[model samples]
Target chain A: MPVRPLKTKVEFPKMLNSERIQVTGKRVQLMATCLCDAFYDDVAIATVQVLEYLGCEVVFPESQTCCGQPAFNGGDWDASRKVVRHTVKAFEGNDPVIVPSGSCAAMIFHGAQIEFEKEADKDSVAALGKRTWELADFIVNGLNKTTWEGKFESTIAFHRSCHTRGTKSSEASLQLLKSIPGISIVEFGEAEQCCGFGGTFSVSFPAISSSMGNLKLEHVRAKNPDLLVSADMSCMMHLAGLASHEGKPIKAKHVIQVLRDALKNIGLIK
Target chain B: MAHQLIDTFATRLRPETKAAVYDGSKKGHEKRTKLLFDNYAKPDDLRKLAGKIKQHVIENLDTYLPATEERLKENGINVHWASTAEAACNHVLEIMRARGAKRVVKAKTMVSEEIELEAFLNKHDIECLETDLGEFIVQLDHDKPSHIVKPIIHKSRREIAELFEKNGLGAYDDEPQVITRRAREFLRKKYLEGDVAITGANFVIAESGRIVLVTNEGNSRFCLAATSCHIAIVGIEKILPRDRDLALLLNLLGRSGTAQELTVYTEFISGAKASTQPDGPQAMHVIFVDNGRTDVLASDCKEILRCIRCGACLNVCPVYRQASGHAYRSVYPGPVGAVLSPLLLGKNFPQKADLPKASSLCGACNEVCPVDIPIPDLLLRLRAKAKQEGVPSPGTPPMGGWAVMASQPAAWKAALVAGKLINFMPTKLLPVPPLRAWEKTRDLPEWRGGAFRSWLKKHNS
Candidate 1:
């Protein structure tokens, strides 16, 4: 199936780095990661609602699929290049590409570039990388919505996915969440540690993965937050799935889902 | 096939050992973090400088290695070169035979373990004693060192007490001080009576022909004091361009390895002491062992040779914490071992090919690395190398099928629809081993694969 090109020569304002960032043009291309498409559609729905509420037009390119992270991380660059090439064609545009996953966004920005370094598509991937932003980063930095008006009367323990280390997405999630009124952000130990949702790593070493997850959950439980929130669903899936299997299911949601709920409670979105 | 490595990992998953490793490594990680941060206002900057220095030395080995050999030779130190582990071990045996050295007390040298020196020497009727307390315990138990710096990181005090009692060191006291005293007393006579001292060099100064040894127990100092002959087994990658490099690298090594400001004893030897001096060795032998390091240096992952043997990567690794270092089944373990062991295996790289796949690519190892080695990137490179060579990796699913499905939207959509059938099936019915392994502990979310596309299409219209 051929991927239709996105609108051509749409010159959006340059990404602002000033103290006061004004997002003059708010159109963004949504790369709903495969995890959201398959298992967590609500995250995509919430993402759209939250973006729309913040006065941004979100476009979903129909030909989009997985970001080839699974293959790229597993050391199969040949297969990764095949899928990543399709992605380059799928999201070809000047509009800022917003991703809900730090891992997938990093794949587009970093991993894909490494895979295509020797190919003619390297330049195209580099351009894509410049425009790719994780969702919260797009909202806070790209869209310039630092202060959230909606109220949320629940505590959350955020899991900063290990992939988010080299990106500002983790900080953006924290900034947006803390800006909301009535939201209590609880602190936990080993906040920098991984939750063990390392794509193929979870399955390749199940006992170790489960043990690491159990350790993370124990720390999360100690904080006793109402929700386990993160920008990446891959991590949430592993933590929430393990917790459920252990008969102590915790309410887990993507950061956007929580934002959507807050906006809904305040009558900002129907 | 998963090959022999995975079986080694699975078979060594003892619960108690895992716990010991977990506790010891976590404490090390926490302590290293605190010390490094407290000491340096910008620890990462220091790490980068150290990395650049090592990289400079590695890249210009043609200049520095020969310069090192000349300086040491000029200083009256006998310099020998060994390209393989057997040759390296044979040099030590030849030295022992020449001197008719019956008893040898050794310092903690991981490279010696790489060459399996003690076993080789014992097989040749020369008695070699491990003087470092943790290494001493490991040798007594006839076990391989689990961790690079802390050989007994996987052993509890109770286990050590039993091992010591069984070895007739003492009647079995678990107190830390008592254990140390018992081992110290037993090793005291051996150190004084030893005919030769064998140790590893942390770094060799090419400018002055000096070798540095750092130890907490001062056993290396004892070894040097007692024996008239000193044999320093040096890896070819251990050269520093000048003595000034030690100010940065030694600080990093201490803080990264055991969180010490400086190891209790940082002894630097510049050949044998002047003839007027009476206390030090009369002859010094430095053996530069390659043993596949040059093979690694030739590969794209040569940045790994910058490692200072800190063991910080092992402490920070989640897999090492859970599986323990013994699972790696090599002299080096954890992140550094994962990269080095396979390359060292040469044609047998296929034997330990699974080592690279053992990581989650968490990037923690890269971050904690004192010399700023890009360990995760190196691991990925090795993984790609293995695949390019047609090595079979059992646990990793073939990406050929995934590539086909992901590249075509129509096929991907079709797979999504078919994936929902998994919601109706039992978890036990999950066909793939990776999925089966995943479902063993975690529940799968209800499959709503294609819902987002449908919702987006309608909303857009």
Candidate 2:
């Protein structure tokens, strides 16, 4: 079955940010994330565009790659550590690291707490943990900007990925969505429940994982939303994957994509 | 993949995953635990006080337990220690045989469930009756206690009504009170006439030589009052130094467990005191069962011993909400069970090897735990253990392939670029287990951004 694009129409006001956040001339190296790098190219593009719109310099370091969560989650710490070392070195400068996916951001911040053993690597990982932020969180708390001006008219149910809940508070995504003018945040009952996209978890306990996604999608169907949105592309892929196969009406999207479309709608970016 | 375990997960989770049921369970659990925790006038003070009290007990268990045994002995309570489940059951059976006690009445006790005490007793030509309403329902149906505290949580009142009918209780309405009343009427006789009563303690108070039991049902007292031989089986982890410490534990335990301010009936049993009445128990026995808990205490996951068995962790766990207790295939279930079962049972218990992998590492279980056991962290450690021990599936990578693929940036990038084409490959030919699983329910996403290296070269450069 062909994946269906979200059919919700967007409307926008002239101003993008209700209050322009002061550009600290600070750097936010965007961790385009393995998921965004592979499948959701636009999510990565949208993340960069949104950051630049906030007057923040977004850097995509070539050395940056997968955060090694796939291996970390699969209990292959050796693989995780190697990739993490490469990622740590890639994002080495003191600039705050902003990851597009909550699961990846959480891996750097929370998962890093244990993966490193040597003093130097441990210090580096902990420092990275302090600077790392999921994109919505980096936008709202890191930049101190709550409102973004955009034209969005859609009823979308939000799925807060489990790692996002584990590593950081999920209010940033909700706050950012509310900032958009015409966006209707549909109350999906199980939004906080895991979509069961636990990296290797989806594959390992596939039945439970599939059951979890179906449950989440069922909640989305109950809300009867135009789109099912989440911060983590892993969740988006898992949910959209199952929804597309099952021929469910709901389409999965990264919240960043919705925000990006709103930015374009309001002429904040073309 | 453990096909049997997967089937268990699938069948149990399918019906309950409905928004009203799944989210409702999560909501009820979170509300119950968080309300007490958040609204507690001094939540931190309470947690710290309870934590310190438990820490003190666990650290000095060797000292406190013997001291407790001495005190119980002084109070005329026969103290017995069992290092294993078989030993624990033998102790109870030997006592039951010594007293010629055939009918045994029980209260809500997960420890006995851990030891499979009821089945052992039944095999020894003894009848074991569960006096608590939920436990009774579970007993009648020959099912496992799905939730530690709420034994029949997974069973609806209608199902319960049917179970009661099957147990020869004729007809009853499918409401909670109706079923509860029927159980009350039915079990009242067992509690009054049962030759021996077996119950588990909430906390074994070492200082005063008393084991505290808190039950909402009035059965705990009836069981103790009615039997001549009363046996209290308690975990070594349950020891607390002082009786006064029950104030905070009881407060948090009740609130965190069922959202009640306190369970209606909290009884302290020191021994057979004031038992002049003909019906009152004449003798009391205290059984301290190690049952692999000492091994748990010795391990790095020892903090799991701080668990008060409040079932608060079970209340909030997403997997527990989905799979319930039975899907775990262990007497223990939920997030606490996920970590503890693997450690306590060790490698010989093969079914539990995949139990930790059952969770999504969501951290909700730890978030809601009153004692604050880092369940997700412990689960991760188990995942590492499975890998270290050469367990073949569920988080243990095959031949360290992930390490080889992930270490080389060139290989990682090549894999990324090839991910799109891999999606189109013949499904059976895909070498990766995750890829195979990912392909089962949904299509693999296409790599549309091209290899990130080229994009970064064009953009970041």
lDDT winner: 1
Per-residue alpha-carbon lDDT of candidate 2 for residues A1-270, written as tens digits (9 for 90 to 100): 111222222111111111223335577788888777777887888888788888878887765667887777666677678788878888888787788888787778767666674336687787777777888877887788888787989887877777765343368888888888988888876555778777677766777678877888887788788887888888788888887778653577888888899989978798
Q: How much is B425 displaced in model 1, in angstroms?
A: 2.9
lDDT of 1 at A129: 79
Question: What is the Å distance of residue A8 in model 1 from its true position?
Answer: 40
lDDT of 2 by residue, B1-461 (tens): 33326335656464633333355457668677557756676674576557656666676677777888888898999999999999999999999999988999988888999999998998999999999887888788888777778776776666777777877786857877777777788888777779998999998877788889999987888888778888999998887777777877888888878888888999988788564655568889989999888888776567788899878778676667666677777777778888878777864645577887877887677666667666777777677677667676643335356566655667767777777767567867866665666777887666564654465467656
Name the docking class for model 2. Answer: incorrect
Q: lDDT per residue, candidate 1, B1-461, as tens digits?
A: 13235434644677788789999999999999999999889998898788878877777777778888998998899999999999999999998889888989999998999999988999998899999999988889988888989989999999999988898888989999999999999999888899999999999998888999999999998998879899999999998877888999999999999999999999988887687887878889999999998988888788899888989999999888887888887888999999999999888998888888888777789788988887877887888889888888766778899899899999999988899888988757766667777777898889999998888888889
| TM-score to native of every candidate shown | 0.93, 0.87
Residue pairs in collision within model 1: none
Best prediction by DockQ: 1
DockQ value for model 2: 0.23
**Candidate 1 runs further than 4 Å off:** A1-25, B1-12, B427-430
